[model samples]
Target: KDTHDSLRDENVSIKKSYQDLSMTKASNSNVSSRAVVPEKPKVLAPGLYAMTPKYVPP
Candidate 1:
């Protein structure tokens, strides 16, 4: 039957993929995945300003 043939083909491909997954999974299971650690922002000091004379006569 056409339906049976397609089903068998799908099963064959599925089995192949399952085997690949199993092979790769063995190495991955030993070590965990790494993620970037969040860093805290540094605080900055404010700049100081000098006062100037408003009036000057020569």
Candidate 2:
């Protein structure tokens, strides 16, 4: 019974730790996604400008 109780406690703690880690990962991904958004416009700008010249010449 004692061993079973200990195992249960350990399982709960492990689950809590995993939950915390998942939350941290989720928040980090959110931050990274926000950071990535600004870069997309910069990437698109160059492509648009490159195409503009080609279209203008034709």
Candidate 3:
């Protein structure tokens, strides 16, 4: 009985972990779409332009 209960508890925890991971992935996907993915700047003239990451923390 003890073993069965432990197994059930472990399964529940595993299921919750998976749910959290899925939620994180979904949120990241949404955030990624909302992010302004920067494109390579075309240098029309010789000038140094500061570059930044494509994704910025909201």
TM-score of each: 0.49, 0.54, 0.51
> Positional deviation of 50 in candidate 2, in angstroms?
23
> CA lDDT of each candidate?
0.59, 0.59, 0.71
RMSD in angstroms, all models?
A: 22.5, 12.2, 7.0
Cα-based lDDT at residue 46, candidate 1: 44
> Residue by residue across 1-58, what tens digits does model 1's lDDT show?
9999999999999999999999998766546343222243232444422322322221
Q: Candidate 1 has which clashing residue pairs, if any?
A: none
List residue ranges in candidate 1 displaced over 4 A.
32-58
Q: 1-58 in candidate 3: lDDT tens per residue?
A: 9999999999999999999999998777765554453467645567743444664445
Candidate 2 lDDT over 1-58, as tens digits, reads 9999999999999999999999988766654342223322434554452232113221
For model 2, name the residue pairs that clash: none
The candidate maximizing lDDT is 3
Question: Where does candidate 3 stray beyond 4 Å?
Answer: 31-58
